[model samples]
Target: MNAERLVRRMIDVGALRFGDFLLSSGKRSRVYVDVKLASTFPDILEMIADGIAEKLSGVEFDRVACVELGGVAIAVATSLKLKKPLVIFRKEEKSYGVGGDRIGEIRKGERVVVVEDVITTGRSALSAARRVEKSGGVVGAIIAVVDREESGREFMSLLKLSDLIKAYDSFDTTKS
Candidate 1:
């Protein structure tokens, strides 16, 4: 799908939110990409998966990894689309039966691409990449559905903050 169409859908679904918000990075922002909301809609989620998959088409990776709460849906969809294995990381390690921080196995030296819903400071994605490294997986890339463009981190994303902001501005102008 085209970027404009995806942005429109995101707006229609109330996924791209505006106004003051506190990000996971502990920073304040007026714009927030609520990809978790988008995931609730299968069509939107599919578009997201398509975008991520396209980004990884040329990149080589053995598995896709992401943390729970937000990135799970996108990662799952992308993993399915690419027919690749998925590795999920928990924000906190579990203490119960078969306890561990991750859900799937990562073979030694397997290349991994860390997936995230949004990239702000990139701490979340980077942390997942580090975990992949610790688990004996090589970090191939860090990909997100949207890049907030705040961190200046080297990563791949389907859409950037500027794209959303431009679309939002045009939307507001049309509404006026």
Candidate 2:
């Protein structure tokens, strides 16, 4: 399915909600996109993975990286769809472990793409980008399920990591 249809389903499935809401950035928002359903539903998740994989076509990326939690499944799916390796960025460095809070299977000078389930202020993705860059991964792009028309996209651009982000209206739909 296309992004439009995905958006319609997200709204129908209560994954995307419109209201006055407080964001993690301590900012108020008129919209909130919760995409757990899309990541969990087989058809929908495959659609999302396929869409993202298509976007990666012709792009030479050695690995796919995703932020903690939400991005985990999506990144894995995308990697599977593209037959590429997957790595996950944790919220915090592990107190003790082999790859706790690691940049995910990335080596110095490896190519990477950051994935997220949603974006609002873009802080999380930016933070993850820094870790990836600092660890020596060349970030190619940022992918999100929703843009939220907020500081998220700008934050990525400001960081100069990647202004290249892709999102669909799937998280913003009418007739809910």
Candidate 3:
């Protein structure tokens, strides 16, 4: 997948916005990328999944675990593209039903990759990873759609859309 093309598409779809804004982390920012909106488009979602899958081509992971809400769709697309099973992690354990925080069959000691839409504080992804570890699964890596360039907690290994961001800045979408 072409990262530049993906980035341009994200801009066209109003996923990336430039303005002074407050973030969920309570920080001020000049740019905000709502990847959830981008994921709503099947073509863009497929590009995102393909990009992530390509990045993880050689990486070893038994399952793709996604945090609740934002990461759900992208995770599903990525899991399908990679032909790997998916595990969903809730922000908190469900009160009803199975009464568990996680949904899906995850084997103990299985290697897992955490997928997320955006990484700001990195808490959501980290929390998901912690849950995986607590459940006896090993977290191999964390993948996100955008990094937001915010100084936050770093993961042991992370794959982000840095190249895409650079492309967005350098490429002129008007000419295309």
Q: Rate the local accuracy (lDDT) of all candidates.
A: 0.90, 0.70, 0.82
TM-score list, all predictions? 0.96, 0.80, 0.87
Candidate 3 stretches with Cα past 4 Å from truth are: 152-176
What does candidate 3 score on TM?
0.87
Stretches of candidate 2 exceeding 4 Å from the true structure: 97-99, 152-176
Q: Write the per-residue lDDT of candidate 2 for residues 47-157, one digit (tens) a residue.
A: 778777776676778888888788888888888988888888777788876747865478899988888887777888888788889888898887776665577244221
Q: Mind giving the per-residue lDDT tens digits that candidate 1 earns over 29-113?
A: 9888898998889888889988888888899999999999789999999999999999999999999999999899999999999
- Better lDDT candidate (1, 2): 1
Relative to the true structure, candidate 1 reaches a TM of 0.96
| Model 2 RMSD, rounded to 1 decimal | 5.5
What is the full ranking by lDDT, best candidate first? Answer: 1, 3, 2
By the lDDT metric, which is better: model 1 or model 3? 1
* lDDT score, candidate 1: 0.90
How many steric clashes does model 1 contain? 0
Q: What's the CA error at residue 49 for candidate 1, in Å?
A: 0.9
